[model samples]
Target: MDPNANKYLLFNKLSSQDAKKKLESETFKRTTLSFYKYVNLKDISFYRDYLYREWDKLKVLGRVYIATEGINAQISIPNYNIEKFKEQLDNDIYLKNISLKEAIEEKDFSFFKLIIKIKKRIVADGLNEIDFDSSKVGNHLSAGEWNDAIDKGAVIVDMRNHYESEIGHFKNAILPQSETFKQELPMVKELLSENKNDKILLYCTGGIRCEKASAYLKHNGFRDVNQLHGGIIDYKKQLMENPKLENKFIGKNFVFDERLSEKISEKVISFCHQCGSKCDMHINCKNMSCNLLFIQCKKCKEKFKSCCSTECKKIIDLSENEQKILRQGSINKNRFNSHRIIN
Candidate 1:
């Protein structure tokens, strides 16, 4: 797919129906929800084709992945079509009655297109079947219970990647100094090796990854292992139910979609890497050739013009033809590996 082609989707930002004539004619209101299930599928291509055709007709949008292991999805649906969407999933044996995490703030349109791709693993932990057993999953804990465990000195471990954890995490949560999800398991086991009897609580963006991860910890001799049921999304919902526990989670939850990250509280836990100022905003490199992830302060954003580095800034100024030739075959060459701002 050409990077400049209409291969991507855009959504969000809308005016009230009464405020604009263009918006007044729109009838549907969208809701963003995510769900995942780990099941052995006989034919993934068949399932993929079936879902793409069905969902595209329903005007659903978001990225979805299917593998022999299972399926992971983040999708937006029109409010009136919610029942129809649920019925569609319920009709499938593997996805029937699955718990879906609803977003706190609903956007106009969360996604502009539907993308379903086949991959080796749903969450990209890079672990083979022998490495972890998805069948013997972890103990699921609700928000109040999770808070109780934290107070009782449970070793809270953030199960997300470093960049995701940078924006928000539980207070004093032990973050593995890892850039990828694949690195979290062994590193977490090593960190909690001494406290085998201590309650080890794990959490991730959605509850998908930790479902297997917590099981992996118990397999490694961690006696008391538990996980945040439904992960941060569920926690946020529980927090809304009880205003007293508002401060439990400290920062924004980094999302993979267009919202980028969702704010849980007003507190800012991360700083702009370039200016050393308090800012948790994450942006991709403006250099189309190198879309490195970095945090740029509003001041630095204006100064650097959203480029990751001086070299990238110069590259961004190049002519379209010159940039195209330079970028040829660079997509798979790992040019942005060293430029990742997360430690």
Candidate 2:
């Protein structure tokens, strides 16, 4: 697919008039909620098509993925249409009343497009069914309970990628030195295998990954396993409800969308990887051909011109035609050549 051709379809930056009209004409405010389930789906393409048609009619917007493994969704819907949407979900026996995590920061139009893509796995673990059982998942803990576990010396592991963890994580959480979600699972198991019976706490951006992860850990003979009830999104809401509950989370929470990240607290826990400067700004490569996401300090940003490194900056400086030939897909595989970009 041409990136430029689908830019408007992928994201609709609402005009002021559209935003005002949505607010005024809609009977109730919209809520952003996310949820995921890891179960065998008979036909992923059929499910995707059904959801696309059903949600489009209800004016729903957000990203959704259906796979042979299960479904993961981050959606926004008007309050009036909430019941209808729930009905649509419940129409399928597999998705009845699944707990949904409401977004901490609700925007009028957070998503302009309703995307439902089919994939092999919902969370991209790259593992077969025998490796992990989603049916026998881990213990779910509330925010307050999670805090108590942390206070009681439970080893907390950030079950996300290196880059996501670099931006924000539990104050003293153990982070795996892995780039992809698939690698983090076994690495986490090895790191905590010695303390099988010890209380183990796990958390991710929206709690979807942790669901299956906790199960995998338990299946591997870890006796005590627990996960955040609604993940960090819920934790943030709890903090807002009680200002006294601040400082539990130490840094920013990385998000997948354009926002890149959201501030969990005033504390800055991460430094720029390139310049060793105090910074938490996560930016993708300015090069259109290689938009690899990474964190860079202001000094490094000035030097590299917002590219991942000098090499990427040089690539972007190439003429349009030359850049096209360089990006023929195979040649660009290892071009960025920076571990910092992955971290």
Candidate 3:
């Protein structure tokens, strides 16, 4: 069904929960995948509208964004229609030969709707086109190569934000404190300013951020920069395929979905912010007014009823009337920051 054939964002009318349940009950399984490229797209609207109509027929669900530069998508293709989806993509001149990374770990409800929209840039890094040459990105290192470089003393850096790194990251990686990628760009420059000539390694959730980040670093006169070929998702797949590939990356990897996280190693590297116990599970505060995302343990989750702090806990405990009034003037962080931006 072409939900948006007659209007804009027609799928928004459907209840997300309702659509999710329908997709879950389908006979065929769902295969979650993501990919990106730096090709120039002329008509953003035509590209977006065409994909929405065609992909929807194949029972594809998930988010997709097309910009003047390229596309960034985290989509789920129905098992039966996987070949059809691929065939259509390969046939398209712009999308042909693009790499698609399948999720190493995916749930049935990873996504529930199909959305395609036009954006300014595929990944917003707050960089002008004149600043860096996107074509001249860093070297792409495989899982084995990345591991070897780290073993040989390459300065590893986590390209994700502080909240993401708090749950899990490769050991000895320099994780900046900034929340957004825009802020992270300059912060990384300053953190490694003195060692600009040394070997620098970067990795993110799915490699998109690292692609842009590596280029930015190189533009800033950094020498010998490298990035994981497919980010942590590919790294985990490699470890599973080869038992001898000692998993240097510890703890859960923060994801942008209902699953929220995927475990890479058995080791827990972070403590719950509320109780300080060894935990890596992330939960949003229950209070709609202040739904800050933070790591929380089972004990703390139960004690605080899933709220982040005492202030938020009290707000959630109030009557519905009072809670609504309080939310009128406050920023409603009830949704995940990443999900909100795409939607």
Top lDDT model: 3
What is residue 118's positional error in candidate 1, in angstroms?
1.5
Per-residue lDDT tens digits for candidate 2, residues 205-272, read: 98888987888888889998999888888889887887766457878887654356778887877787
Model 1 poorest ten-residue lDDT run: 7-16
TM-score of each: 0.87, 0.80, 0.90
Candidate 2 Cα lDDT to native: 0.77
Regions of candidate 2 where Cα sits further than 4 Å from its true position: 1-32, 76-87, 90-92, 106-112, 298-303, 318-322, 330-343
By the lDDT metric, which is better: model 1 or model 2?
1
Query: Which pairs clash inside model 3?
Result: none
Q: Rank the candidate models, highest lDDT first.
A: 3, 1, 2
Against the true structure, whose TM-score is highest? Answer: 3
Give the per-residue lDDT digits (tens) of candidate 3, residues 181-292. Answer: 8889999999999989999999999999999999989999999999999899999988889998989998888877667788888888888887788988887777877777
Error of 2 at 71 (Å): 0.7
The segments of candidate 1 whose C-alpha lies over 4 angstroms from its true place after superposition are 1-27, 107-109, 332-339
Give the better candidate number (1 or 2) by TM-score.
1
RMSD of each: 6.1, 6.1, 3.9
Task: Look at candidate 1 and tell me the lDDT of residue 197.
Answer: 86
Say which prediction, candidate 2 or candidate 3, comes out ahead on TM-score: 3
Go through the candidates in order and give each one's C-alpha lDDT. Answer: 0.80, 0.77, 0.84
Candidate 1's residue-wise lDDT over 64-135, tens digit each?
Answer: 999998899999877888899999999988889889999876644555557788898988776666865667
